[model samples]
Target: MLKVQEIRELIKLVDQSNLDEFVYEFDDCKIKMKKHKTETVAVSVPQISTQAVDLAPQATAVEAAAVKQEVEEVKEAPAPEVKESSTTENLHKITSPMVGTFYEASSPDAEPYVKVGSKVSTDSIVCIVEAMKLFNEIEAEVKGEIVEILVKNGQLVEYGQPLFLVKPE
Candidate 1:
């Protein structure tokens, strides 16, 4: 969990400094803050490492169990569509339009919005980048099939960071 003061400080930093993104690591916690250039006032704060996480894992344990079940279900289900691997040279890189924390899903308990080999359009939501409490949906600018995901889930991403490599259809 993030503190309100921290978010305020991050937003203040962005407004006061020339830097577009900020990252902080304290003990067991890591916080990433970023602001996109598109929107007038957009702030995202994605907390990757939870230092103050409660040791009582009842809620978390249950969620993990559910996820395991879902994994089993996927294994039992038919395979998804096969997609051709896009060459690096031919790939049109999908980059982060803003500097924030990159998230594969809306929340920890949810499935990722997009994956490698997934078909996507220009308006497809590839992922979400969170800065200051605001979650900004990142869209694919070009129509194509996702070939490779450059960043890992919950990873701290900088401005103009390469998020995915798409093969244009």
Candidate 2:
């Protein structure tokens, strides 16, 4: 039987890679993960676990959160010929410090704190994340331009999930 933590690690690997499907058999249990181009990671445990039968569904929920990030990256560069060389290496990702609902503005009618092409300093408030009825302001720890918004307004975000990609100054 595989531990729950081990299963989560596998899910992360498959999400980061381009593989469409991943299968692993441990003991009498078989865990499979399938990725659809337009959807989140799907996990299926066809075989029963000798240790715990109830753990299957929990693993599915974990994999479901793999990403809304699969929504194609929004690139700022219009130059189609720009090579991949050292482009992403210089970028900094502003990730969610906690799991919550991501909001672009304090109020729904207010303007967003930042947007693509907007410049930011380390102390700049970029967005707000609401968790357990508390609203937390997220900052741009790195000085840079907002190159991409990874999650949509009102979207649910997980801890350590990339919220924005910044081209550092």
lDDT of 1 by residue, 7-27 (tens): 443544454466666676655
Model 2 TM-score, 2 decimals: 0.52
Q: Return the TM-score for each candidate structure.
A: 0.51, 0.52
lDDT of each: 0.65, 0.68
Q: Quick one: best TM-score, which candidate? A: 2
Candidate 1: residue 53 lDDT (0-100): 31
What TM-score quantifies how close candidate 1 is to the native fold? 0.51
Cα lDDT tens digits, model 2, 106-131, are 99999999999999999999999997
RMSD of model 2 against the true structure = 11.0
